[model samples]
Target chain A: MKILITLLASIFLFSGFALAETPEQKGLAIAKEDDKRDNGFQDFTANMVMLLKNRQGEESTRHIRNKTLEVEGDGDKSISIFDRPRDVKGTALLNFTHKVGTDDQWLYLPALKRVKRISSANKSGSFMGSEFAYEDVTSQEVEKYSYKWIRDEDYDGEKCFVFERYPVYKNSGYTRQVVWLDQKEYKILKIEFYDRKNASLKTLTQSKFKQYLDKYWYPEEMYMKNHQTGKSTLLTWTNYKFKNGLKDKDFNKNSLKRAR
Target chain B: MPFIKPHRAGWTLLFFLAILALFRFPVKVFAHEISGFAAGEARLFPNEALFPGQNDQSASFALQPEYYHEFESGSSFTFVPFLRVDSGDQERTHFDIRELTYLWLQEDYELRVGVRKVFWGTTEILHLVDIINQNDQVENIDTEDKLGQPMVNVSFYRDWGTIDVFMMPFFRERTFQGTGGRLRFATPIDDDRVQYESSAEEWHTDWAMRYSHTFGDLDIGLSQFIGTNREPTLLNGTDSNGSAIKIPRYEQIKQTSIDASYVVGEWLWKLESLYRTGQGNENYFAWTGGFEYTFTGVFDSAMDFGVVGEWMYDTREERATNAFENDIATGLRLAVNDAASTEALFGWVQDLDTSARFLFLEASRRFGDNWLLTAELRAFIHQPMEDLFFDLRDDEIMQMELAYYF
Candidate 1:
């Protein structure tokens, strides 16, 4: 009787384990949870310095002021105004992203005294000649990619969940991207990009995260290295101020011309 | 005139004093800030001018300062003052209000009043729809520079598109190079002799309206203007020396313009066209269409190469003063995605009927912290005497400029 009872108990436990969720289901659940935790910030303004290095190790820096406003049921809106290099000073770029459709972008050229609408198909191109692409700097919506949880591993002395995501938008340069998120805070710590040919293209690492308002987690620095070319860009963010009461009107095309 | 007029030497002194005053102002004056740049340029003509008494070199300096103040309720004020001093040409040495406007922003509408500059059109070769401001001819021959226009503008934003209405109270005449300038005609243009078709002349009330929107990869705009024509027709006249010359005569006209651009991948296709009825029933049409293709990260390097081509046409052909009727323009742009933001562009425009060609090369880069250096070369070939640019055939020259910003 004891032997029969042991056999039945083992069968029941094994069946329960076999009915667990798949990798894709697990990844979708994780992404939803991450998005929920990051909501309700409303708006933010920050200053950033981008350092670019070439194959020869020559370096150049750019200073910019960044502002972002969260939109309900869509991606965030952002504006970046350049303040350095004299020649490009007062140049501004406005981005209006969407969850299911193509994004809208406009560039304000101070010299031309006009605002130019940029092509959304050029999202795969570099941003201001940096290693980061236009899509990389833009706010990534949950609907932008389909995710699949790869595995769990230890990264930087913290437990991390690794996932592979495929972009849903057309004309994207990358075929897939692998991201590492810490289990405790659900914050992204590293990402690897693959080109359209399924070749390794770039790696981005985030560090120096500081909690704001005791509820928001933002990385103070992000570094991106291009694997194809021996070039890299380091973005150091400072003066982060959240919940600035910025409204939808502040992110319109007219504001682009008025941006300092 | 109530405007200040300082002598050549006095202008330099006043410029420095203005800079000093700007620096002395306190930073905490309002909720916004002030910023600007100062630049000096020295131009040299490699060859002798076709006209007599023209100088081979000229020195010029410009100061532009901008100020902004924003209220908590979304109302804002902006002031931009511009001053330029040319040692060789008095007409180029002048000051104007580039922009001094107050803006009130609402949930879906905006209102602006004062002097402002507005630009329109998409094709790089020609800006046919951009007629809000008069040309500042003394600034450059490219037609990209403009004098500010005084007006009241109202804009309404909607999900479908944006509608803009403009009411201009005064008209501004186009500025031309003085007799002493190298690029001037054999006879000088007397500013006071300028003629106007309207009885109100410079004070004629003008109006314009524009509708613009974006649909997916396509952006389009349509606008109409009823006012004094920004482009003046040259009329027979005499200068102070009693020699025959051309006097600019502003005419009343109605113009309707349309501009559109389609972006696909790394390619951009643009078109700009306009129809105008004025100058004694001699109405005509003009259009420009072009495309640009860019190869990013060429040869696995941090560089981009862009090829551009455009065609310009006019119903009146050679009779057009722009001399671009029935012409083709081609250009190459190279960008070295370096930290200094270095770039170079080469363009050539050729008349299909006369084989006349105009070529230009421009390169610029930034250095140190707040300095920018630029160089340019211009040349003309096979220009016919009937063309407007015929007098500039011998003006092939190279130029270098250094600018500083604070």
Candidate 2:
């Protein structure tokens, strides 16, 4: 019980309850509170559609199904199954995300009945020819980034906290990301990404929030626009179901081959 | 010589019955989907044919239709029927069931029954450990095309690893091109007159078990198979028409294999080795190992280039069954990360002892959303008279295929 008290005392002291808290401390406190609120959902399933558009106004689409299981002390485990474009249908990808180390990923090709291990260095690559990077769509653990509070602002007339977070892991495509979160519930509203040269690269807007189980809030749609490339991707999430009683056994390499 | 055994008809009847039984399962269907592709291909052989009754050009069409159904209890059934029609070779015009399986999946264990295709290997150039399915030689010379095998498989997922046990009751003979095909020997392969070392013949049961696990970045699999050898010994003989021919002789053998792949950063190192016994005094060991280094996002563009190299070695160097006794295979893979998903592979294989080499190029690009265009060029160069592939010296060809998927 003494260790528990020490942990609680640390969290209480660094949570900005005391005076003279630095900007970094307050930013970390906000992130920790946000992460805590989003925890304990157990498991969830959803259907996602990705619409990719190029500079010439051409468009293509992909259909995917997702299942995520929250892990206690590490990152969440997830699986994604492809269902569209005809050729790549029934392909599945399984991922094990970690907080401070390289993540594990595998891809299952239905035609070949083969599963291949993917390198973690490919986290920054485009996710199936879309504008969204692989890391962007994966689970976001609080320890993956370092945060600093910038200011108190209003996002569309609502009270919000604007902060800049630097990626803690190497091989990230971005130098820093400016995040806008609602101060009332700590829900993410928007983000601006800066490239390695410290130039504006992309902006992501998450809207159409809906509260599930009267506690967790999720966005129905997310749009990302790349400024220099004139390309964009719109992700639409539907059929969200939570508390599906998924177990750890459903997130292994064998599950990848059985995802279909 | 004799003709094809009477068991061929029995296998086909069993295949149809399996499909019928799977389709009649009692379950609440949550989803039903259908998708597949239809393709047309044309090939042109530049040089003259090596054997008589052979053609310099060929045209073919292929169709594959897939049916999938998922039940509310987390069980599924899949059916895929395939057919091909070739204008030059009558034997190439054939029909086969690619996949007809009913899968019952639980949290920790799963069961699969019917005709299915399973691949197990790590090396890129060769698939020494992938012995579950019979190669469809009429489809491609690379041995990548497979005919589904009838089996009952059970897999258990546990903390230690995944274990799969298979029971296959029927044996399948590898199909060969007819006399009119360009890539053939001076003596046609008499697939009809097949001989088996076992008295039980096609009724011989095959058993296989595999244990696979992942350790950090290293993934490995160890498998053992006791069954009829897929690679047959071609016994030289004469047909009833007094023509020189080769007869396929199947023998019962036992094999053990290990395949491993370790990924670090942009490098992937792979190895697959196998030891085959019970094949008389011809028991041998062979292995292939290689490394692939990828350069991703080259020059800030969404393009990936990978260099692959593998060295193939065999214990019985000159007397090995196939061509890769002692050889080196190198290739380059290019993936252009675009909306159309364009990709290309160029490779070369050379024998270490003789002046035999094979070079090939394959490229494919998606058109719109449902169509794909593929082109391939294969050439055989500098083959000595004593080389095993000497018959292929005049069999170089250029092929193009267009496929429409739905």
Candidate 3:
């Protein structure tokens, strides 16, 4: 009888251990859990702020006054005003981003007296000579890269889903990237970038998640650091709104000339 | 004797076949991009009468044609098939596609490939951009033809700049020879205006590194190159006088250079210095500075004016008898209403010697958004070299061209 009770206890413990998951499956489960946190969001408009820090320990803050108009199925557009650095107070940066095609961009250099088009295909280049590429400021869709479950771990007391993403674009400077999604907020908590040589190059971290819409969660602050170059770009978002009646006609090329 | 080896001839034949295989077959094993395109351009070439003894030019004509194309993203696989001909000279034709090759990018980030162009230069205006050479005339030079290798090369392109190693294995016949064993040949340039020159059993490899950076309002780049050229004759040490000349089958040449430039507002400044060290160690350096200012018609913002001046080294100096020398040249350009449908430009080139001058003028008018008509004229005046006084002629070189771009 004593032997039978001991055997039963052993079987029960073994069954519970079998139910415990591996790191990869745990990561996928956490990702699925996080995806459930965002379901009803369709459109959004927001004013964002950014704080930039250099490797020399010098810090500069930029308060961007802008209106972002994003559609549910279509891409997003932003008309931004540089409010700081008295020199560029009135300068504007306009971006007309598409879902899968090339994005048309223009910067009005008050000095050059002309609106110059940014024809560089390397959108992944450093933004304002910072660690973050221009693509990072834009929204992340589901189709830009292929993902695989990497591992499951606890970051800052919150269980996280870590997945590796490989860029599908031919001109991408990064070969692969690892993303950490929060289990409760579904927001991307961190990202590690691997360059073409499969070497770790940079990392992006998100902090201070704020719930804007009832169903949407957004990071109020973000930071990106280039491990190789020791450079970094920090961003802060403020006053985010969803579903403001912005139409397609407002994003026309002719409108770009009058954005300022 | 029956068992003896087939000797050097057999080895040479095998080597030639191996090189041919490297290009004939698409070694898909080597990763590369393959894209196709269609392009056509109609250029208005100015025409003029040749000197009395020289039959070089007569009437102006336009050559326009649509052609297929194959090109790589980088300095790799490129194949362009096109033909151009002039109306005045029906018998003379120009072939555009001269060199075609595939690339094999290696593991060390070096391009171990076949048929490629090695570029060396950093400024918007390149003084020593001589990796691949071309004719002085713009119309006669084809874009596909490079002063590069028909053989093989390994190149590394980094964010800062590039480094290239190359070898040219080909054979050609010598046509003309002068004193000091100096030789020249009538290069086999096709009607398409593509030119390629190679030495008998000759091989050459070029190695160079370039770095670029930006500081304050300036952009700077620096490069250094060293290489050697091997020839069967150079090693044979045969002199024109039938005496044994001590010449290496190969000779060494090294060039060290620096390019620095600054841009502030509407002004631009650029400088280049090159030091050549070898059998004839000659150091050649050139400097150029330019400034441009634009004024909109406070009344109509579209109207603008541009003025540019450039000074180039002439490379010829009487003091340097043991080495090749050149003279310096200065050019001035003036353009008005450049953004309008109808635009005009006048240019002048002055040789420092004051014995030679070049005058150039051109005009273009755009009809609607699709069609454009252009005409150009050029005149070369050689006061000292002229044996006959055909100072000027009417209708010397007149040509018109019409083009549509989509």
Candidate 4:
């Protein structure tokens, strides 16, 4: 009779969570689920346009073509080819991101036909005169940060799970980031970045999330605004296609020269 | 593009850039596109000219039009023809086919034919392994410009690395400053009276091979070249007019070189070494090793500061024609990381044996989307009489180039 009663009680317990669950555990679980939804995307390419606005609302534009190759056990490899500002045309940047070690970046100068190995320490600096830092555009791996559950809230009329995460990379410019992810699709909707001094620096809002292959979700636009400088950058992605059969060879340093 | 006056041509190019900047730019990049730059340059010397007819200041104008096309059949063609018109020196005002090449790309290998420029080195202050194209020294004293060489090349990419083989048919001779140029030597090189060690002369076929690999944070390259030397041995001779001139004699030589760089976060270690057998009395080995460390996001600002220090050494002491044979170079690099992409480099090279020093500064900043301003200064100080650069003792040059790209 006692064993029967114990079995009945166990059946009433929660299936996805333990009887005693911490906020950290819930946050980690949410991140893992969010990451799991983005799996199986072998490759992707997109044409991106960036509009940068300053304090007086003066604006400039930049055009870039980018490609990404997903790695099964590690972070993704990416390449960006600059197309605008005519002087920098044919210039390319190749990046290799690792989940737990050093990342590598190489810059190809078209004028000299030379490949230069650049330090990844530029993560804290602005990317192409935009409000977005290099770290902000890098591949988001769950292992790169530690998280804690904050609460559930309605962000812009969408049901979101708010969480706070701290970057594990030593060279990261942000002290912490507050993220809001939609609970249904597990897609990140917003991020608030805090500077090294724990001051609010920038806010990034992602919108127009589109689903591809019935499993992957990508934001069509991302807007980042710096609070201190009153400058903003809006990234609009077009012609985004996934599963393009891009290989590892496409992301090497040598391939950058021919990435036209 | 050629034989145009300096100031008027510069104004015309600026107007062209403005009109092009106003229009909706290019949409046919995949198929083909036309892009290049036009510039107005002024070179001023602080000291008196060394030669009789040389002037303290020179004005020049340059224009380059490049056309690139890639077809769906895995074949591509590139054409870049450059022209410059100068008000002072005739040799400095010339035309060049920078690159006119056809490329056939395949999965494992690619083939290229025609005139092209190829660079191979890892050192910053000095390039020891870069021996493919002949230097266009009249364009700049730093040897950054090159006269393209006619070659047939095939490159193969494998799991280990990449291998490139070349068969160069015609060699280009190096260009030197003329008597009217402010930076000319005591006696200018007579290109018309040039000599060659081989009977085949400039038509001698050259062979070269290179293997380059990147593993983790390390990038390495090994190359071998068997050909006529690029740096000519200036023999004291006379020109066709029987005037005192230096006859440039090209020699057949062989060289093997290795260049490698190991990057560790903000610190990059670089080395370039070479072994050559022909040119001088005996065979020699030369090398340059250095490290560059950068401090990014300096003091919470969007700026980067880089410190560079290198040691250059050569086995042949007095016989070495290179001024940096036994020298140390230190430089500072600064980048604003701003929208304009402003950057500056300050370098100083000191001879170990003598107290001679070479100081130079190069800075550039973009004014708008298409206009760029570049300024450079070079000063030679404390030179000994026996130094190779003693000819540059009284020459201090300041140069400015305003370029418009489209």
Clash counts per candidate, in order, are 0, 0, 17, 0
TM-score of each: 0.89, 0.93, 0.42, 0.93
Best by lDDT: 2
> Model 2 segments beyond 4 Å from truth?
A1-19, B1-10, B13-24
lDDT of 4 by residue, B220-337 (tens): 9999999999989889987668888899999999999999999887789999999999986789999999999888778677687899999999898767878888999999999886
Descending-DockQ candidate ranking: 4, 2, 1, 3
Which 10 successive residues of model 4 chain A have the least lDDT summed?
Answer: A11-20
True contacts kept of 3: 0.00
lDDT accuracy of residue A196 in candidate 2: 77
Question: Lowest summed-lDDT stretch of 10 residues in model 3 chain A?
Answer: A111-120
- In order, the B-chain TM-scores come to 0.92, 0.95, 0.56, 0.92
lDDT of 4 by residue, A41-135 (tens): 99999999988888888777778999999999999999999987777888998989888856788888888788888778657867887888888
Please write out the lDDT profile of model 1 over residues A111-179, one tens digit for every residue.
Answer: 778887766665676788799888899998889899999999999988999999899998788999999
lDDT of 1 by residue, B1-406 (tens): 2222333124323443453344333344347777788888888888887776677888989998888787766677777878888877778887777777777777788888777899988888677779999888888878898887878899998878889999997888888887777766666677678899999998899999999887877889999999999998878887767888788899999999999988876678899999999954578899999898877767666587889999999888877767788999999999887777789999999899996999999998888668888898888888888887888888786778888876
**Candidate 2 residue-wise lDDT at B197:** 88
**TM-score of the B chain in model 1?**
0.92
- Candidate 4 — what's its lDDT? 0.85
Q: Which digits, one per residue and each the tens of the lDDT, describe model 2 over residues B38-64?
A: 999999999988788899998999999
Tell me the docking grade of candidate 1. Answer: medium
Instruction: Give me the displacement of residue A223 in model 4, in angstroms.
Output: 1.6
Model 4, residue pairs in steric clash: none
